[model samples]
Target: MDHREIVTSLSQEQRDHLTAKSDLPGLPLLLSHWGTILVLGTLIALKVPFWPWLMIPQGILIVFLFTLLHETIHQTAFRTAWLNEAVARSASFMLALPADWFRYFHFAHHRFTQDPDKDPELAFAKPATPWQYALHVSGLPVWRGHVKTLAVNALGRCRDGFVPPKGHSKVRMEARAMIAAYAVILILCVYFRTPVLLFAWILPALIGQPFLRLYLLAEHGRCPYVANMLENSRTTLTNILVRRLAWNMPYHAEHHAYPGVPFHRLPEFHALIEGHLRQVEKGYARFHARYLSELKLASRDASK
Candidate 1:
């Protein structure tokens, strides 16, 4: 069946059922999310015998909060609007991403998933060479982009075509507030002469960012420039733990297809669209290997 046929086959009742938002699983999910962080934090605070080893998991968890941020931007993380906003702001702050700015930026991404010129995400396409891939995976470029975005937006220089003029004030205010908050944290760290922030936030994020970059690259990395979500996006078959951590984002084609279907309901949506999906990968590892192999072949062909 074609994409439109697959979408039209679903009755209104089924659509409503899939789109119905609720907090049924969100509460427990949030608990588990924070619980993991608390456990890692406590272990770090106590300086346990193997505390250093804990950093890997801690950093992974910390950087993976970007998934939560992405979910909140869709306002699908919780049934309650305020809960979504609160979590979005918190996750944005932790990741140094501006929530207001990201909402529009991400919406643009959803609107134009793979449009070479229109999709802001396509501004920096996936790496086609080994050196480019190495740099892309390093997460340094992402950090630099975020810093520049925040600084410019804070200066009331919001020029992104996707961001509405009416929302520019909010974007500027959010950036300025974020800068102030970071300043306060820095001041507190200096006054207390403590490395708490370093161990707790900075170092962990730095260590964990590359993993996030690797995971994100598979989303639409090698997909063709097409309007069909099922074709342009990729759905990765990953383990339950990774699914939970990513808030079921591994079903990415399902997401780009019907973004209104909340995180809790994506698996059901996937079941509906599974046969119609054109881009499914077994796992991130397999996806990466295939992507690199193809890039290498392309490089050799170009040289020839």
Candidate 2:
């Protein structure tokens, strides 16, 4: 069934229960996420034994804030509107993504998911060959894209179709503000003559982005370009830790099917519609394995 049909199939009571929002669940999760980042950063700052290695996990946690940013843009991360706005702005700064701009881009992605001609995500081609996949996952392109978007928007040259004309000013202002903030940060880092920010934030985010890339690819990679959300999005069956890190975004198909359902309640939503999911993966590892195998097969066929 299509997304609307699936929602319509649910009883009113079930629908109401699933869509209920509360701030309690999200607050603790946000706090714990930030707390973990703080602990890791402190260890790295203190230069504890094997401190360099700590950046790996540190980076993972930092980059995964993209998931938090994603949730906030949808305003489903918390019931409180101001909380969502505040968190979205902070996460966006950490990721070098402008929240106001991303909201428009992401909403358009949902509106035309997997549509080759329209989806802004489709503007960047997915990696097809092994070498291409390596470069893609290296996180280089993502960083480049973020930088380019920020620069262009700040210059008031953002011609992205998804961002409305009225929003152009807001997007421009947001990008300019982010650039100024980054400048201030860089000046402070230089004046202090310390690499604290470098080791604590920059390096970790760089090292951790590939993992995020891998995780995000599983969402719609190789899924069919169809109208049905269940068919178009792949829901990866991941472990509890990964689920928690990503704010249960692993239940992507459920989220796409019913965008109103908050992050905290995705598990229950998944249970209610588990049987209907068409592109479910057993795990991220399995998904990547199958994806690579298919890519190899396709390459061989093309060469023949």
Candidate 3:
């Protein structure tokens, strides 16, 4: 989006709310991130029998960090933009993702929304004809959704090395710096005898990533796709655990609908637009628990 178009999307009320200071983030956030890094790292080092599987917690922790990185990049999580950027680095370290690269790409998701060519997260696109729609419903492979998130994240790094930053030297440096950071993490895990790769990389990609597909589908799965922000993405009403750990990203619709509004403020935005989001499903389990059943029904009906 050009400068004015982007500015226009966020209503004045939304803009005012974003500037309001709230204690939504406090010591609890800092301690949570610190605790996870310490606990997960120590567990990996301990090398005990089943403890090696501590990777599960470690990987989940990493997703939180990544999500939080998205928040901080937008400076939505803290009063001071500088402090948010500080927090984002820690998130990046935990996830082993290139934070600077993410900061750049995620903004694109905002500008483009669910536009297929412009928006990479456009899993919600609908087919034109009934036959094509049937193919889509049938082609929705549950496992592949998860698989694709990881595979794409892996492929993204290479492209990120070259993706132009928005004329900011700091962002450009951050891009290069993060790539180097990831490279260093890999080299250390491989050479210095750290199990970072097995725990942080392989297990998460193998086990945790597939879980993302259901969440992805719930966010903006397009039976109807349009510029209406509410229609394009979903904001799952998560349990406290998922809400806290996953960094409130379950508020996917709100995030898309208003990119400048940060995670802590998503609830306010949701309440502001409550009348709007009632139809778009919330809660991960509520949406996806019957996905397989729905698929079966769709298939049988199509056949008949």
lDDT for each candidate structure? 0.89, 0.94, 0.61
Q: lDDT by residue for model 3 over 1-304, one digit each (tens)?
A: 3223444766787688764654457348757866876677676767667875776776556554656677778776777767787888877655545566566556776777666677655543543344544444443342354334334444443333324644345444554565567688789878888776676445654454444444455666542445666666667787878777766777776677667666777777677665665335557677654554566677788789
Q: Lowest-lDDT window of 10 residues in candidate 3?
A: 154-163
Candidate 3 structure, TM-score to reference: 0.70
The sequence of per-residue lDDT tens digits that candidate 1 reaches over residues 153-182 is 999999999899999999999999999999
For model 1, what is the C-alpha lDDT against the true structure?
Answer: 0.89
Clash pairs for candidate 2? 59-204
Clashing pairs in 1: none
Quote each prediction's TM-score. Answer: 0.97, 0.99, 0.70
Model 2, CA-based lDDT: 0.94
Model 3 clash number: 3
Give the top-scoring candidate (TM-score).
2
What is the TM-score (0 to 1) of candidate 2? Answer: 0.99
